[model samples]
Target: MRELTRDDVNAAVKGGSVFASGGGGWVDHGLEIGHAALSIGRPKLLSVDELPDDAIILTCTAIGAPAGRDWQMLGKDYIKAVQLIIENYDGKIAGVMTPQNGMSSTINGWLPAAALGLAVIDATGDIRAHPTGKMGSLGLASSIDYETIQAVAGGKPEIGSYMELVVKGTPARTSNILRTASDMAGGFIAAARHPLPIKHIKKHAAIGGISIAIELGRVIMEAEPDGPEAVLEAVVHKTNGRILGRGTVTTKNVHYSGAFDVGTIEVSIPNRRLTLHVMNEYMAVGDDEGTRLTTFPDVITTFDLKKGLPVSVGDVEEGMEIAVFAIDKSKVPLSSSVKDPTVYPEVEEMLGIDLQSYAFDKEKTIYA
Candidate 1:
């Protein structure tokens, strides 16, 4: 176990933003949570092996869009969400883990852990930000009998109203309900759900994910003095990822459908064109040659050419030059949901892409 320092927090914001792909919460909000947690209490990072197998664990995360202008979340909302979950849970919670790594999601469990005096498990449901809750529900995608209880809190405080919601049901049903709540509560909200034993987390969660992000961020920060190219090289070396392509954004079409922001980004090179699909986060990428280069479960991120920082889809506009990176799934510690074929059908159906056909060999296709 290690105590997180200010450097860890800054690096997380940088690296977490990259891992967010396109859809994690805001970076400023993440900083607030990280700084506050480190201020009042020392946030310790514990690996799953350090805890007893019988220990109870819960996934703490924020739901909704970073671009949701109406969405308002406060520090109290994050703590309140977990407190509500503990109130209903019959078991004694041992620790809290993040659903995914993002600018804010990386720090999602910290505030609650500090306030409630619980350990922050160094693991995540998914290494990258995703739209649906089931995408990060560990291995519960195939567990039809599994029922989860979730608590949500956050809303437009400017309107003088903040709402709290609690629901118990199958992961899919509850996830959809939470998405709807996000729409009604403004746009974004704090959430806690998908409780499991430490044993289950050990079997399905991405072990040592937080540490990986922190270390990767630290490496990138250390390389920054050498230049953006050096930073990019460090990331590729760290994750075995490669730069798929680099070009200016020729076109971008993004639409917010109350709950999710679904869209596509098109980039043009001299002889190649790259197209990306987004549903909160980048899901798939294809080229003008009619080849599906990458898909979910693998890391797909874009960096602005000028600033060299990871750029979210919502933050991108037409004519912005960006570099695209694609990492092999094998290089990263993946949660079970990412490997399960069932969790992907909906995204495939929505985007109309055959992810299964490319799930294994597509990395070779990109490298070729």
Candidate 2:
């Protein structure tokens, strides 16, 4: 097995997450909070090829709304949710596995490496992020059973806080519970789904996302002003992506209605000005010159112009002074529910004056 250093993990998270599609949540924050536990044990790169078939495994992931994740609603929820799920199973956990790609999935999958004191499997079932466990090809695969139980903090019982999925219906039930639980925590959730055979996990998950986040975070932190561009350059090139645009928010037209943080960000650069519409996650980006950018199956994120760090949708404030960038989703694939029209059709529709006219761009999209 290849032995990856601490710094290598950081580079990978920073670089790997550029592909996270905005739905992966922010890699910066998670990176900042990670490693304290991981540093405890010199985590090893356990190879999938070396894993045994009979090894009992437990699955865990960071669960919460991406929208809430930025606001610090995800920490305890990730550990608690997985602890509860593992508790439900009467079997012993021989090892662990991650779900797949995206900043959210990467962070969720790897967080356990340090906290649980378990060996990190090299791969996961799906290669990218999917909103619900039912959607992954693994949900249909043999070996992993879906029997589940759901619990919610409150609200409609049909939308159980947590759901119970039987072996025959584990896949569908988990999918339903995944959305329901996330919404309960304020429209997002983290879940360890489709527990793969220990060996299979070694075959798919983009290993080292946790380490990448930490490394990326440290790089951003170590670099002072004028660092955003360098951090962006390192991440973009490492992930094989391009920087969509970088500009400051000149105006933030924010209005609060219900549980949503709704608004528009008008940004200005030396040469041009751009506008971004946000709801939960950033929906769309456009320029007065008519360069309209929509994210679906791709991610859109806003960051500090001088610092190159990211902030969440729930925490956005007016005139915060920031730079906005769009990451292509074709790199880190999420689910249709997440990348669908409902996530952010405004880039096309709001700009076009018609909603349905801008269908969800399922070809790999993400938004800030």
Give the candidate number with the greatest TM-score. 1
Give candidate 2 misplaced runs (Cα > 4 Å).
1-33, 39-43, 53-59, 66-80, 90-92, 97-105, 109-117, 123-172, 182-190, 198-226, 250-294, 327-368
lDDT per residue for candidate 1 within 1-368, as digits (tens), equals 88888898888887888788887877898899999988888878899999999999989998886566688888888889999989998889989999899877888988888888889999999998887788899989667699899999999767954789999988888888998898888778899998899999989999888888888788888988888788888888887888888889999987887677877899996689999988889888889888778877778899887777788888888999998888777788889878777777777776667776666564444541
Residue 121 lDDT in model 2? 60
Q: What is the alpha-carbon lDDT of model 2 when measured against the actual structure?
A: 0.48
Give the clashing residue pairs of candidate 1, or none: none
TM-score of 2: 0.62
Listed per candidate, the RMSD to the true structure in angstroms reads: 1.6, 6.8
Which ranges of candidate 1 are over 4 A from the true structure? 360-368
lDDT tens digits, residue span 166-195, model 2: 232355544555544555544544455444
Total backbone collisions, model 1: 0
